[model samples]
Target: MQVVIEKRGASLKVKDGQLIIKHGDQVQALAFNTIDSIVLSKATVLTAEVVAQAVEHQIDLLFVARGGKPFARLWSPYFGSIATIRRHQLLFSRSPEAVAWMKNVLTRKMENQQALLYALAMPNHATDKIIESAVLKIEEDKQRLQQIEGAKLADLSPRLRAVEGQATRRYFQAVNIHLPEMYRFGQRSRRPALDMTNAMLNYAYGMLYGRMESALIKAGLDPMIGFMHREEYNRPVLTYDCIELFRTWADWVVFDLCRQQVIFREFFEVEAGGYWLAHPAKRILIQHLTDFFEDQIEWEGLTRSRYTHMSLFAQRLAALLKEYKTDKNKK
Candidate 1:
């Protein structure tokens, strides 16, 4: 289980070998073994003991800003075997196989989007037509990806992104028709979202970023190295690349909430910058995502929670990288 500390002035510490949380007049204690991770926003405070205990218990400590973007993380250095995996990761990042891996990732992402569009299709002919067209376009994009020829990811990255972007545009346009006008947007926006849907999407994506990063680290992969996403200073680009495969999960959650029309005016604050999810709205989104991720689903003849699926995928990727041998004679 994951524990979140978002209350203003909330404090976390260790007592009698148990995790203790105190906020205002309420206090709670939990066993260290029961906790998998701890998320704390800037408003919360933690003692050194808590950090030490978390590291000792191999629990991840994620710190986020008010906007729900994770800025820092703490985890046990002993979490995963490192040297061989990290070394293999660097070579794998530049290999032709990495290009194929990215194609598979993008293909799965578009497939999920098409599946969502189909699931959301209604009896209305016009809407069904839009959804059908979008699915066909996405299918075409997937075919283009399969046919892409590249010696390295750099050779294919631009074309891959262009095709993916076009397909994504069609998918979102289809989704827009199903949304209430207040929640719909002309396009997907980030940094500061222009509409309610984009705002919620940005926040949900931020959470997924953190989760993906954690999974990568625990699986002994270097999150900084990537295949499709360009390398940059201090960026976890591999997380960005892997995240594509699961972004539809967040999309489905946010879309469901908007369709329910349970959103209140106070749930979001609009500033000159953009829409910001308020504390209440953040809590609601977190709860929904946590429940959804923890629920079991069948895939590839095996049943597991969505969260476990991500973890296993990371482990499998790391294992593949470890077995990868660089061809020194290519030059």
Candidate 2:
């Protein structure tokens, strides 16, 4: 079984170690052990006992704020996962090998970004031109990064920031061109996505982020610690960083759905420069996004669902961190 998400207007209760979900007039119960993550789309009435039980079972509870934004998450520790702490320490140790590993990680991220751009550019020559420009910007950022001294981490940071902004702009431009005018925003801004399509996409993005956060926690990584994204006061910077690697996947899913006409433009509205998805549209988009993630996708010599691939990637990262710590201890 995979992750389980419960929407609003639904109630969940723990009875004899089983989770009973009540939706409308129907009720379904499942063993709590079978559950991985629970998403609360809106207000939920969960008991303190149930919360405690979920924590004991290491089940992640994710809460979505207004406009379907994931603003808070709660997770329990795995019994024997302490390597993430060690990895954090290694990252701060400032050793040559640590720096090398960080560089490798960043290189992989760049490669993934390139792959996504290639996919987006496949549809048209004009789009290809835009993607090529973005690619050049990425390359320039990489070159600048290589020339930066270790003492100038702050200087290298801005290059990465510029590259990310360029990449996102390229992506959004392609996306906006394909989408209805209602979904287009001249600049990236939070809240009130400009139309139904944007609202649905934003909600889907939130869901994906919550799932990635749970995966990170399960792998024992500190969701707040990160390299590409700075450690903000309370933001889960690591989750934000890792999400950058996979957000293109979500974008592609939404884009394809829009192209296929599987979703309707009438399902969304624009108000106050923000987009809103009707409840029905939200339901359909969520299900479509969920299925897309669960569908099998080939990666790294294995055929695994995107969801599984994400989990495995987090685990691999954790293992790499452990190896780094072991080498440090030996030295």
Top TM-score prediction, candidate number: 1
lDDT, candidate 1, equals 0.87
Model 1 agreement with the true structure over 186-216: per-residue lDDT tens digits: 9988778877788888888888888889899
Instruction: State every prediction's TM-score relative to the real structure.
Output: 0.96, 0.81
Total clashes in model 1, counting residue pairs 3 or more apart in sequence or in different chains: 0
Q: What are the RMSDs of all candidates, in order? A: 1.8, 3.5
Give me the displacement of residue 58 in model 1, in angstroms. 0.5
lDDT of 1 at 71: 95
